[model samples]
Target: MNLESPKITLEKSATEAFNFLSDVQNFKKLMPENISKFEVLGEDKFLFALKGMPEIILKKKEVTPYSKIVLGAAGGKLDFSLIGNISEIETNQSTVQLTFEGDFNPMMSMMIKGPIGKFIETLVTNMKTAI
Candidate 1:
């Protein structure tokens, strides 16, 4: 399954937003207020858990300079990736959109799609202030 977030303009430049997101530790600032747990495992990985979800461990998989960042599940029953796409709109401003791709059976996808969509929306909304 694939889900994309609505693009949002950021006050920071593409490079600035990319730099902030490339660091796993900075993700805490962008997580929803209902986050139950959060921890930086290393320079390239982090773990977090929402109120009703199992803890998720994510590792930085790839980065394309200031244009994109891809994070994948480290080791879990679920296999998924989260991608951040950044585009510069002005010298000091940019737009960002997030994509979530998951490998799940149709049944599972149907069961979780709504929550995942909400999760993506919350993350994108937080970026307006967290970036």
Candidate 2:
């Protein structure tokens, strides 16, 4: 598996941050135009159709106030599990740190290498604007 960590700083409170983060469906609006068919499931799960691929499921594994959240998604085509996590949330003078990490399968790693990276960047950018 390949792991990468990307962090984003947000100018928002913990609760406000959670509120914005918890709304899973907004991903369609936040992600790039290549993304489509976004569907939200319950509090922390979502399924979306990424261009050129079948639908993928993202399930929230955990969540903690002013702390962290972990989401995982994987399929047989992948050599390993793919897990994305947001952790080490801490408030600065007027900003909060939203740290993102991804663990990907060796075979499919390169396929998502750039898009996933961009996805995280957009995730933070949207979070900043949402909150």
Q: Please, what are the lDDT tens digits per residue for candidate 1 over residues 52-129?
A: 899999999999999999999999899999999999999999999999999899999999899888888888898898
Candidate 2's C-alpha runs over 4 A off are: 2-6, 74-105
User: What TM-score fits each model?
Assistant: 0.97, 0.69
* Cα lDDT listed for each candidate: 0.93, 0.57
Q: Which stretches of candidate 1 lie over 4 Å from their true place?
A: none
What is the TM-score (0 to 1) of candidate 1? 0.97
Q: Any residue pairs clashing in model 2, and if so which?
A: none
